[model samples]
Target: MRTQVAIIGSGPSGLLLGQLLTDAGIDNVILERATQDYVLGRIRAGVLEEGMAGMLDEAGAGARMRREGLPHDGFDLTFSARHHRIDLFGLTGKHVIVYGQTEVTRDLMDRRAQTGGVTVYEAANVQPRDFDGAQPYVTYEQDGIEHRLYCDFIAGCDGYHGPSRKAVEGRGLETFERVYPFGWLGIVADVPPVSHELIYSNHPRGFALCSMRSNTRSRYYVQCALDEKVEEWPDERFWDEIRRRLPTETAEKMTTGPSIEKSIAPLRSFVAEPMRFGRLFLVGDAAHIVPPTGAKGLNLAASDVRYLFDGVREHYAEKSDAGIDVYSQRALRRVWKAERFSWWMTNTMHCFPEQGAFGQRIQEAELDYLAGSVAASTSLAENYVGLPY
Candidate 1:
């Protein structure tokens, strides 16, 4: 098979790119190593930055999101047994949409199907070949047959563990990574959320986040040791721990239920420099990863797709290489800012193992200042609403 672009990975990043390109009359195909059901089954963060919501609209996958996604102008931050609200919309004139990543993927996949775009699921041993040279192609095995896809360019939209990033090995690429000493034990339950908007709390024990996927489905997380296992946390124990971390009022109103999904996700901040090499471009987690503290992972992926789509569109529409030429620089600029924000959020909200009492005092002071000062609140609001694209 031959195409204009071959996108490796059918996650949101790859699928969004395919949708944009296909809508623009450019031909592309997506390849995934997992079945569609498995892909959608993975639970992920739901906070949607303003820019990401806009991109979904551009891809013609916004109707359901706009209809069902909850819009929030503010979120609560609890510290010192008090609740402080960050008026995101009031301070930044922008708001976020609380739409699950799963829903976003479904919308994009449905749109892709309706538009007649091709996505190959369960593709095995998928590899990008000859990306550095002009005639780039991808190879993979499917159903006992070896298949080759010739393309003008290859998009590595695969995640961190995927082959896309590794393909750039031996090339002059630098990587920066910091793995946190802790993880977040998250649970999804069928109960009304304790609060209307998300609440991020810092207590003597640990950090906790109260979030929701919908009106009746709550998603919550509590920081845990890196060595902690999901099996160690039963539903009752998880709820008890969550309540201990929240403010008294909020905790009193919280509803408890059997967890439908539970897992522990390690925290890490990783970035690969020069998101492009020859004809291959790294998009989303293939290029960078941020801790979920600030909810930047999925939004960063969408922004990367936006930058890449702009460059690709420019290349095809105007026969101009200028956009693609500067794609790496443009994308990296935004990537670094997000990395900094996510790192800062993690440091401020979580209790570091080595952060002695002095560090704890400083964290408390910072939170107090952030709650009392309009400037500090605005800064938080702006970053939470998302930096401009």
Candidate 2:
């Protein structure tokens, strides 16, 4: 097999990249270790930055999102038992859309299929080879038959644990990571959200986020011990706990229902420097991960794709390597800023049992200042809407 680019994942990042490339008349193929159902089965938070939404529009996949996604001009931040609204659009002149990540991937997948792009699902042991030199290729197995895909370049969009990053180990690749002591215990239920907009609640109990996938379907989360289990959190207990964290009035309005999905995710900040490795480039989760506190996970991946797609386009259209040359530099500058924001938000909103009372008081002071100061609130609003590409 031969292609211009070989992508090693079928997740949102990989699918988005593949769609952009196909639209640009660049031939690309995707290789996935899992089936299509498995890729779409993974539910994720969907807070779309304007830039990311525009990319979907560019790829001809934004119709569904624009039709069904919820647009928000602002979100509420609750601390000290009071609610302060951060007017995202008022401060930054930009707003975000609440669309599930699964839906975005589905749209991209549908677009890819419509365009007749190739994706090899259930590919076994996919390996990227000879990326350090010109003319890189990939090898994988399917149905007991081995095959090789020759491509001009390789995109390591396979995510954190995928073979692309593993392939570059010990070759001057550096990684930085911070694993949080707690995780987010989240549940998805078909209940009307208490508020039209998201609420970030900071209580003595912990941090709780009241978010929704749509007007009728809600997704909620609360901070929990890293070792907490999903099975241990029955619907009734989970509902009671979240209610305790929210404001009294807001809690009274919240509707409760059985969760269709429940899971716990450890919060962490991780980055792999120098996203480029010769003919190979790491994209999205392959390069970095931010705690979901700031809702930057999928949006960050889109930003990475934006940089990489531009670089790749320049390489082909103008025969210039300039964009590709600085791909790592450009992506990391944005990545670090996002990491800082997520880290700061996480530290501010979450209760650190380790920090005791002093820390709690300090956090309350920070939240108080954020609510009272226009400059501080503007900063929060700006970051929440997303920093410019």
- Give the per-residue Cα lDDT of candidate 2 at 32: 98
List runs of model 2 lying over 4 Å from the truth: none
Which lDDT tens digits does candidate 2 get at residues 1-389? Answer: 99999999999999999999999999999999999999999999999999999999999999999999999999999987899999999889999999999999999999999999999999999999999899899999999999999999899999889999999999889999999999999999999998999999999999999999999999999999998899899999999999999989999999999999999999899999899999899999999999999999899999999999999999999999999999999999999999999999999999886889889999999999999899999999888888999
Error of model 2, residue 281, in angstroms: 0.5
Q: 208, model 1: CA deviation in Å?
A: 0.2
Q: Candidate 2, overall lDDT?
A: 0.95
Supply candidate 2's per-residue lDDT for 165. Answer: 95
Model 1 pairs whose backbones collide: none
TM-score of 2: 0.99
User: Considering only N, C-alpha and C atoms within 3 Å, which residue pairs clash in candidate 2?
Assistant: none
